[model samples]
Target chain A: MHEFAIARSLVDAAIDVARNAGVSRITRIRCRIGDLQQVDGDLLGDAFSAVCDGTVCEAADLCIERTHMAFDCERCGTTFLVGEWDWSCPGCGESGSHARGGDELELIGIDGELNDGNQSAPKCV
Target chain B: MMEIKVLRNVFEKNDRAAEQNRELFDRRHITCINLLGGAGSGKTAMLESIVPILSQSLRVGVLEGDLATTRDAERIAALNVPVVQLLTNGGCHLNATLVQHGLEALMQHELDLVIIENVGNPICPANFDLGEHLRMSVLSVTEGDDKPQKYPLLFKAVQAVLITKCDLLPFVDFDIERAKADIRRLNPTAAILRTSSQRGIGIEDVADWLRQIVNERQSLVAAP
Candidate 1:
């Protein structure tokens, strides 16, 4: 499902940071999704856990935050949240639609543990 | 444990690939379209009817995406136009990486217009960006007008919606007005065209809509 792909992206991003920073284990990942995107938090959590298994992100806790998308009405100059698939402006009845893009689906950050001296000693050579 | 602040879009990787694809298409003066719809929505049928019409004035090509079959590609190939089949191999949708490879194969033709017929699904395909100038969705009358509300994301993302199988309207309980209203609520600017590939109804209008975009690109390329 769509949630699985998003979960994969989140895990990959966390892993990328871990590798680049020489972190041995990732503990948590935080993401923010837009209201317009139809992502179910429960499904996303399940997918994240599924994809993180056996990876550096294994057992990592995933935190999700939802954000609202504001629609700018060109007619009445009113910026508002579109309700129930109705893009029409409440003030002027002017329909406002914004192109969907990566404005949503954000990965805020990650928490990880640095490698121990013994584990990182091999890289010193 | 160390806290790191890395604010990034989850779709950044795919969006970058799509931007690259768009750049490539722009350089080549190709008007690429991402065609999406549910299974049996008459996407291929629309292409089968309109390809010939569009080909008369511009060089046309197709990149067909499906779960595990070359059937749609085969159908497009039969039209004697350049076509490529992108097999997702059980994947629900086609991503930008797959489309980049498909575009490489299709690049040799020097096409003016390329239509990527996305895998037959309304929901999954709506999430992906395959480096297209326009995103069009096909919905047949048999699926009912209420479908737009059920799958609002797809309706919201598409620039145009083709209500196909209009010939069957007399036999079905599909309310065309309700369908248009639902679509307009989500997308006020999407051109909702009624089409029946079987009867050749509204085929010219669909072709003309595409033709205008392609010709605009052509005119821009010709400028300077």
Candidate 2:
């Protein structure tokens, strides 16, 4: 349900970048998602296809890169990775209030081709 | 064949809208809170109990989000305060854009505190920020104590957790201490309060907490 809204945003972002780069076709759109998002990639992919219809990103591939949750203990200063909902620091047994990473939900980049140029080099926009 | 690095957040649009909402709230000197919970978690009941107490000192407003019904708004309206019903149709969550519209409608009244009753799913609503000063979630005894572990995202995102329907705790197998421990594991700073709307327990405490927040905001606005 809400994935449709997120997918629409992703498509809109891709189209915005493509139009700015003067690209006619988009090959792929890559996203980095964190564990906190709890999004279903399959559902998001389906939603992306549905929302991208007739748009510049209609044929684009949605590549989702999932990032795991990481935490830094404030008590012992031990940085540790959370396997699944485990927030306690294994070193000092203190529950950390500080999070180090893994809450990312960003559009990393896009792969596309220019309309006027035959140069196939990847444009890092 | 070329890959360009965009490096933009997927929630950038929503986050930008939320910032705009925050600016509006700050400019108006209003303290907004997003109330999140499951469908039958007694969120409306808790509001029903607290709004009266809150309205005695502070001007309060409510924006009710539901899939299709205006029933929650009706409940809040019975308290004789400013209330708006937002129908999401079938959307699982309420986004910042919707909250901006809700604020626009609610801003007509001079409210000190505005509580947005988000759509009743624990998962999807946790992912979106509605530009609230405080985020609180209601969990009922019958919903089971393990819910905090199952829905860690929601528990982790909230600033407070209201354990509602405590009157039924005698019959239910809800382990309050265990639930509190689990919630603390996820969010060390979240305030956990036990409340029973039917018995009028802990309603004043919630109201007093909100009042403190409103007074703080008022002082900040009054300051240079």
TM-score of each: 0.85, 0.91
Cα TM-score of candidate 2: 0.91
lDDT of 2 at A71: 68
For B20-108, candidate 2 gives per-residue lDDT tens digits of: 99889898899999999999999999899999998998899999999998888999999999999998889899999998888778999
TM-score (chain B) for candidate 1 is 0.96
The TM-score obtained for chain B by all candidates, in the order given, is 0.96, 0.97
Give the top-scoring candidate (DockQ).
2
User: Measured by TM-score, how close is model 1 to the native structure?
Assistant: 0.85
Clashing pairs in 2: A122-B2, A123-B2, A124-B4, A125-B4
- Tens-digit per-residue lDDT, A1-125, candidate 1: 68899899888877887788888888788888875567888999899889999998895788787776566666677767647655567778765434333237789887777887222111110
Q: What is the lDDT of residue A50 in candidate 2?
A: 93
DockQ for candidate 1, please give it: 0.34
* Residue B101 lDDT, candidate 1, scale 0-100: 97
Compared with the true structure, all predictions reach lDDT values of: 0.84, 0.85
